[model samples]
Target: MPYSNESHFHPATFILLGIPDLENIYSWLSVPFFIMYVMAVLGNGAMLLIIQTEQRLHTPMYYFLAMLAFTDLVLSSCIMPKLLSIFWFSSTVIYFEACLFQMFMIHTFTSVESGVLLAMAFDRYVAICNPLRYALVLTNPIILWMGIANVIRGVIIVIPCPGMASRLPYCVTNVIHHSYCDHMAVVKLACVDTTVNSVYGLTVVLLVIVFDVIFISVSYAMILRTVYNLPSKAARSKAINTCTAHICIILLFYTLGLFSFLTHRVGHSVAPYVHILLANYYLLVPPVMNPIVYGIKTKEIREKAFKVFYKKV
Candidate 1:
């Protein structure tokens, strides 16, 4: 953390180049971008309201789901408005400190979301694999502690990136190639070698994201194994059905994360526009989709949502 910025070129602001090749149609692109934002906000908002109202949903699984929904809200909100502003108004210049803050919030909530997903997977494992101890194990206090731990872990991992980024000599171009400010993209603007920055960022992705994915995968695998040995078809079907929403979300989240990461790091020949599109998709899609998936897959939530809407109507 000890560094000298005496020779570093500090800029007051950074220019965000919204999308590479699709600059001409930025106004048109904002339409779909706006729709995704609406979907994410309304969907996650509705999910939170539903979770809060339903006393039956005060259980562990629903608690984890609520946390996931909240995380989606924060995760998407961190970037969408700025992206929309860049697209619709060509307001692409962000203050340097604000850009770093955006980078922090986006990465922090993303890591927290991964942790939330891991917690959900654990919830599922306990419910299916050890039904007797589910209540005792994942008590309300324990769940609250898990949520705090997720946020703390994310903070610990990402707090350094922005600090390191701040010390870099950004004598290079201020133009960022993507829609929003991310650690790697911001680092790309730095004129310095940034080897330590790159190493730390890569280490975070590999150690934190990959570790969560592996742990969630193992949890699902064990849950599936337990389901396979169920005494009857009906029980097996029920168990699989219970996990269907979470499994779909896990696949979608990791699939998008992997592709985005690869496009940024490994896809040298890939189109620049594709990189921005994938990056936006990675942030936007899950929040928009998660509520719909949960509503469809969770009978209690589905029924409650319908009742709530029907009453409102």
Candidate 2:
């Protein structure tokens, strides 16, 4: 539906009534969301500390993991507080500038997350397929460059959002269905044509999803071939076990991500709530579960994390 004629909208600014009728659901859902946010913060924080303090985890895999945890911390922080406030205080209104900022941060962190995942896949591929050159291939310089590249990619991909939002005239309804300002959600409110914004957003999604998935698949294929060649059953099993958690994370993130995107574009009314839930899950679940997955599957991280916790106590 086009924007309702409730309020006059401004091109320079817009009032966003966040998540219409959110007050009714806020009281009940806020408690569980608060608990999950706390756990996510603690879990990802502990993982980062363990990786930083432990000498054994100074290698490239753990280095990338540390980066991943940091990204999760950032990604969660960007969205959760505003969501919490909206629930706890029933403050659903957001200013236009603030909305744009939120959208930019969300996209930036999302792009960074994709880049980090791809980097981790490459790390695994090198370790399994070409162990002889693993250390040389994933040197400190290479890892640093990967971090830089991730930041650059995030900035480049999301640069269009604010400009697009700025140009569009919002002369109609301003309520956003979700808690935070999302790219498409904001664009949909625009009174003017949003073809440019939609096209640009779709392009970024394709690059992140299509290009990144292809690279990750290729990396895993090489890793799988190497695993199959291993003579010892124990070695083969161990290698597969090591990759299982990452594979699970990748599947969960991408599947839900694509599903949410598709639903937003194609099947809006019937599955709006489902899309909303999946959108939140796509952002929150990986960060929450990643630590658990790595803690259980990776012996070194598990041991070190416990050791650090005990020492602090």
Candidate 3:
């Protein structure tokens, strides 16, 4: 539907409803979410600091991991502060421009995270499948280029989404069902036909996330095949063990991510509370869990983390 008139074409501000169907308990919910946010920031921040300071971690694998940690930190920060404010102080009204900026930051960081994961998969692929040439294959210059490419790819692809959504005539309602400005949630509020917005959002998800998942899977598949061909049982065990953290991260990130994506379209049957909760968790979980996963599973990170604590104590 087009706007009833040009006078009704724009909304000056939007209000974010923290979670649908749970307004009474929003404060209680904030406790756990606040904890998760703290953990995400501290954990990822520590990992970034360690990787930067520790000369021993000056390799491609840790380099990629640092990139992932940085993305997680920014990603969690982008959503959680605003969300917490909504729940605690009831600060829900956001300017239209600020909402668009938040939408862009959330989506861009998410896409960047996917790209970083793909880069990590490639790092592991070379390390496992082409160990002898790993150093030569992933030179400092190459790793720097990979990081730059991931940032550029996400930024270039996501710049248009907020513009597309923002240009829509949100003449109907300004209350978003989500805690933060979600692209679909915001666009669907527009009185105008949002087919283009929906299609463009889906296309970007497919191109950035689905495409990255496919290539990461291929890289891991090749790594698996190479590992299987190794004659030594110990070598096979070591190879798979090295991948355990990344594999867990991939599963955690994409599984929740895909579920959240599907629920946006096909989740009418589900309770709004459940859908909103899942969506928040989808963003919060990876950032909080990734650093813990690396700390527990990766020997180098774990060792450095322990040593840092030991020295402090």
Q: RMSD of candidate 3 to the true fold?
A: 2.3
**RMSD per model, one decimal:** 2.6, 3.3, 2.3
TM-score of each: 0.97, 0.93, 0.96
How many residue pairs clash per model? Answer: 0, 0, 0
Please report how far candidate 3 places residue 177 from its true position, in Å: 1.3
What TM-score, to 2 decimals, does candidate 2 have?
A: 0.93
Worst 10 residues of 1 by lDDT: 1-10
**Candidate 2 residue pairs in backbone clash:** none
lDDT of candidate 1 at residue 154, scale 0 to 100: 96
User: Candidate 2: how large is its RMSD?
Assistant: 3.3
- Would you list the clashing residue pairs of candidate 1? none
Candidate ranking under lDDT, highest first, comes to 1, 3, 2
lDDT agreement of model 1 with the native: 0.90
Q: Residue 177 of candidate 2: its Cα lDDT? A: 71
Over 4 Å off in model 1, which ranges? Answer: 1-7
